[model samples]
Target chain A: SQKIEQNSEALNIQEGKTATLTCNYTNYSPAYLQWYRQDPGRGPVFLLLIRENEKEKRKERLKVTFDTTLKQSLFHITASQPADSATYLCALENGSARQLTFGSGTQLTVLP
Target chain B: NAGVTQTPKFRVLKTGQSMTLLCAQDMNHEYMYWYRQDPGMGLRLIHYSVGEGTTAKGEVPDGYNVSRLKKQNFLLGLESAAPSQTSVYFCASSPNGQGPEKLFFGSGTQLSVL
Candidate 1:
């Protein structure tokens, strides 16, 4: 069976520190991967996407790295703040389907 | 502009009751989707439509039915609601059903089955 897993534990980090989250999958090779941020009681918002051919993608203070060989993607937030705290989800676009399979997500709490 | 809107932000129904959740998008997207979010489960795709009048089952579609009659509106129906069917439902749309098109989502409807 195919599975996408993320750290279910909530991450607590001090403001101004970098926060790194991990996403791992098994039995699936995806062509594209995406990250989304969801706040409590609200729908998710798109953050960034990285292709299998790309080593890394960066936008503003966020960066994402995709390693097909390892079947993993890492999301990083630099100069993190309390406002940046939210549950981050990683999704994989496998095969030809436009729909993505999402991981359970990891919640990040940045304390001031 | 309201990107996507879901009616009945919150609802509570008894088991065996039937209800329909309405979703409207003003983006004129070609693809629309229905998803349910549960605790410990990120988001499970229920049903999705590639274009108007085309609906397909998704990862978890056993207790749900969906329709996309008009280009801008999509409806999700539960004929006999079950307690396990209680979840936060979200509607999303994309310009096209290909590539890395980002999905625009509605606020979501919180449904509870008693």
Candidate 2:
């Protein structure tokens, strides 16, 4: 079965340190991979999107790298702050259904 | 601007009861979707619409019904609520159905089935 998997356990890191989260998929060739941040009791907000052809995409303090050959995507947050603590989700789109399938997500805690 | 709005921020229903969750968007998006979030399951798509008057089944469509009667509105109906139906429901819309469109989501509706 096609599946998207993220680390289910929460990640903890000190403020100002860099935090990395991984997303891995099996049996699916996605055209696009997207990241979203969801806070407590709120809807997810789009963070970044990286195409299969692109190795990496960056937006300010956030960076995403997609490795199609490895079937994985890594999300990085530099200069992480306590405010950056939230659940991060990765979604995969095959470009055929106009829909995205999401991973279970990684909860990051940036402690001050 | 209210990008996406879901009415009744919270709800509780008994088994076999019926209700409708309303979603509205102001961006005039061409695509709208309903998703339910549960612990350890991520967000599962229930139903989606490409445009007004059109709807399609998604990854998890059983026990749920959807309608896009207006361009800005999408409604999800539960004919007979079940305990398994309890989840945080979110409504999202995208500018178009084309490639790599980002979703703008509503605050979400917390539904509890008893």
Candidate 3:
């Protein structure tokens, strides 16, 4: 079975600082990877997707980098704000059905 | 736009009881999935449907069953609820079962079994 590991259980950062979260996977070759944001008591919201061929992708103040060789993905939130405090999850596309295998996620808290 | 809606935002059940979670999508998506979220285990898939009348088991399908009789609706049934079954259940849909299509998730349903 494929396994996904997220860097840490929780992360605390000062507002306006850059917050980086890591996701590593094993025993699977995914065509694409996705990132999602989940607030407390809510389902996850799709944030970004990057293909295996793509090294990096960015949207607004958020950026995601995929290193297939390393089987790891890095999520970066620039100029983090208190509003950005939430859990971030990383998932890998498993098959054509697009069934995703998700990581445990990293909870981020941006202090003001 | 009511991308995806899950019925029974919250529920409490005693062991051996039964219940169903309904998921409806207005986006006319071709793929729908059910997942459970616990404290540490990420979102573990329970079951998924690729299209109408078609269903498949996912990573964590035990104690759960699913049906997709209609293209826009997916139902998850718990034959016999147990305390271990308590978790937040989420429903998601994608436009298609291919490419880089992102999933649109519904507001999760919190299930508590005692």
Candidate 4:
């Protein structure tokens, strides 16, 4: 079985700083990886997706990197603000189904 | 356009009770999924449907059943609710099942089985 692991614990950082979260997987060749931001009491919203052949993907203030060689994917938020405080999740589609296998998630708290 | 919508934003049920969560999408997505989020455990897939009338078990499908009788709707049922079934449930949809298939999610259903 493929297992996805995130930091599990919450991450705290000062405002305007960069927040980076990690996701690692075991024994699965994922076709692609995805990142989502989930606020309390709400569902996750997709942020970025990086293919197996891609190294990095970037949005306005979010960046995601997939290193298949290391079986790790990284999510970064630059110049983070307090509003960015939420749980960030990493997921994968291992040539499996429309459903994705998600990591435990890392809660981010950007304190001002 | 309501990309995806879930009914009963919050509910409280006791053991042995049964309930169903409804999910509807307007994007005409070919795939739909149900997942539960728990503290420190991340999101666990309960069940999913590839298309209308086609359902499959996910990583954790125990204690739950699903039906996709219509192309735009998916229903998740808990035949006999248990304390272990308390969690926030999410529904997501995608156009197809590939390319990290960007997902559109509903608000969610917060269920507590006491």
Q: Give the TM-score of candidate 4.
A: 0.96
* All DockQ scores: 0.78, 0.87, 0.84, 0.76
True contacts kept of each: 0.68, 0.78, 0.82, 0.80
What local lDDT score does residue A110 receive in model 3, on the 0 to 100 scale? 100
Estimate, for each residue in B15-101, the C-alpha lDDT of model 2 and write its tens digit: 999999999999999999999999999999999999999999999999999999899999999999999999999999999888888
Deviation (Å) of A5 in candidate 2: 0.6
Clashing pairs in 2: none
Chain A alone, TM-score per model: 0.97, 0.97, 0.96, 0.96
In model 3, what lDDT does residue B12 have? 100
How well does candidate 3 score on lDDT at residue B106? 94
Sorted into a CAPRI-style docking class, model 2 comes out as high
For residue A104, give model 1's deviation from the true position in Å.
0.8
Candidate 1: tens digits of C-alpha lDDT, residues B20-72:
99999999899999999999998999999999999999999998899999999
Off by over 4 Å in 2: none
Each model's lDDT: 0.93, 0.96, 0.94, 0.91
lDDT of 2 at A26: 97
Per-residue lDDT, model 2, residue A69, is: 97
Worst 10 residues of 2 chain B by lDDT: B96-105
lDDT score, candidate 2: 0.96
